[model samples]
Target: MGKATGFMEIEREETIERDPNERIKDWKEYSTPFSDDMMKRQGARCMDCGTPFCHIGMEIDGATSGCPVYNLIPEWNDLVYKEQWKEALDRLLKTNNFPEFTGRVCPAPCEGSCTVAISEPAVAIKNIEQAIIDKGFEEGWITPRIPQIRTGKKIAIIGSGPAGLAAADQLNQAGHTVTVYEKADRAGGLLTYGIPNMKLDKDVVARRVKLLEDEGVNFIVNTEIGKDVTGDELKNSNDAVILCTGAQKHRNLPIEGREAKGIHYAMDYLTISTKNLLDKKINNEGLDAAGKDVIVIGGGDTGADCIATALRQGAKSITQFGKHPQLPVKRGSENMWPAYPQVFSLEYAHKEAKAKFGEDVRQYSIQTKKFVMDENGELESLHTIEMKKTRDENGIFVFEEIPGTEKVWPAQLVFIAIGFEGAEDAIIKEFSVSATSKKIDAEYGDFRTNVDGVFAAGDSRRGQSLIVWAINEGREVAHQVDGYLMGESALPSVVNA
Candidate 1:
């Protein structure tokens, strides 16, 4: 630690976000970069605990409790506090391949497990992390580190998302020729489309993609494997193939009036809006929500994004519904230190919604019974029922409808953001890889598939998860692939949990 009592002396600070009222007017990143002094102050809040759970990367209560990438959190925090930005950036990159992305988007479980959080607010780890990498770029410390030697081994990575990108970066560093194929017209997979632009700027993603290209990783966009190219072709041409295709198979709500015209999947709505923006189209390709009442189903980041997107598009009103009850106002006794706290909180999109609408848009314990359409077959309302969790005959928990709680709410557009099921079946079938449910049947920790020299990583291997987890999978799988190629490998595994 830079100063022994730094954590005690300093109070945690976060990056300043643009006024939500003003930010909702446009689709741009809302957080401003912190000043040099602010960055140091935030970094100084890290305690450098004797047993730092911040970077432990363990699974707790069926969810991650710390940084899944095992980021050197305390080391970098202290380095930043000491004004050793270059060293901080170096330490940050030792594990995470893309701090810029994670810093902006990650939920920051590390903060939840921070020792400082037990008594007071946690360290501004995510802000400090972003600051370190941003400073490195500003000072021209970050540059392409092209391998001095070529191993003559070629690897193909399917999907240009975080996982694929991380794996490609690692394998390329090991002197292997890595090529990434993305089905979308642009790289970054869900990063390019699934997330709204206001949260993560597309320019930042483009810049990173260009840097990866400079480092000698070939990216083939709009060329999907098993369609534009065959899986067998990839296996035949490359020494090994790693599938990083994210779990994008969205779960559908097949309720009554499900065929209404105004109903759409959350990804589809988000994707078209982004595509239109990137293509310089003024009308959003006819998916505009201007002057329309909107209701988003499910309660998660994606649901919040829908509300934000609708607001930006000039929606008349927006409401969100969740099947589960609202979380407690504060962390419960059962979820204290070192565990991700289950408490009431508002993310960026929700804040944006509240700012525009003058109230929180969330309505919990409600389930959509059906989509009610108008005479034109366009969604006009939603029939819903309140729910409460209760014990079943087998002592298992289940959601049961509460009688006399049925209600109908007006809505012109509806978005289902209930999350994904798993990877698309078509791609999985094409690869002929064994799978369990929606995920690939790869050995845990080892991302190998049944097919020889074929591996799976990211959401394709693990179900729907955080971008950080996907990056971890990509890096770990690259090690396995590297070892298989050379009979030994020097790439380190990040998963110690």
Candidate 2:
């Protein structure tokens, strides 16, 4: 809103990414930081609309629209445009606890709902967000703002993922002692391992963790509440317990030869690769994909990540399989500007794959039937069948196999990249909360479980979703927990960072 005609005068400028051929050579972030001028120009593209639905963190007619954390997108953009970076960051942090992480990795539903996008190109909201944070770090404005007073209340957060980190930040800022428990050797949950390094560098995650630790927040590494610390001990020690464990149990494909040694879950493959990179050098890890034909199942971001990672590892060949038909070349009427247009898109990984190979490595309406393996228990090929939609047993929806569509494709390794089911059952069981098929059933307003003082947030409550949603869940849950502990609380549930 700095200039009345800003959106009309300035065009959106996206952050430049490193050349694919060169970036995949090592375990590091591929996207480059925008220059000061470039970022300022991008910020200038914000219309900062009257409604500003860009940061409207709420639902619309039962459809998920607007930002999840309700980030003050236009305010921060104007601040950046005016070169008031410190103020911009303060505005950014008002709703979002970690713009540094989500700015880089989130799908940016805010941009999707931008009013400018209805007619003109959407503002470079995500790029501006990342730039503000990057600048904060450079200028030392990203220091921990620890609370000045203590509330004498203690909170325990399980799972050191984005959700857990966000919850800890909120609860601690409420002047309550907070401790985050992580089962992994390192602190950041999937941020450390589930995602490939090329997309998000581990160093950024490490820096954030260090900052959180210095903020007087306690971190217990390699310790799980259910396994290491008993639930009773945690409940007795802390006034309230919040579960932020993400939905990580992978959705499996039911097919023949599913137990083949060379066939594995995409998370397992990425976890080992990331762990090796963190522990030792990535090059030294034995997960080399050189000279192997790899087949990745599913067509989500994770599947595309596997394709990119394999290509970077010098895989001989790579192919991806998807069940749904390909989207249209242009946006449909229902998917006009904003509303997260469901049109054909080229992500970083897919672009890399197309550049390395002759074409995009994706096949629509294709499904894996079985894993074909060699006699030595090694995978060697894939038996798949073409599928089409048809009515089911209950007259709902089902996938029907096409006759004479069976085929065998050569593959040395296979990765199942389907999405997750829910949070791990161990801790969920230990809490002994009333549950649903996917997540725990807690009172909506209070976020309290059936067991008193125990709460569920993030993916554990809402199911697997964007990192931004997890942050909102954490922030809101902290407010409820704080209010429950004290007569009242000042913690903000101000959604949309």
- The lDDT per prediction is 0.89, 0.82
Q: In candidate 2, residue 231 scores what lDDT?
A: 88
**Model 2, residue 190: what's the lDDT?**
85
Report the number of the highest-TM-score candidate.
1
Clashes of 2: 9
Q: What's the TM-score of every candidate structure?
A: 0.98, 0.94
Please give, for residues 207-297, the per-residue lDDT of candidate 1 as tens digits: 8899999999999988977779999999999999998999989999998999998888988999999888788886664468899999999
RMSD after CA superposition, every candidate: 1.4, 2.4
Write the residue-wise lDDT of candidate 2 on 248-325 in tens digits. 777888787777767778888888878877787665233567788888999998898888788877999899999987
Best by lDDT: 1
Model 1 worst lDDT window (10 residues): 488-497
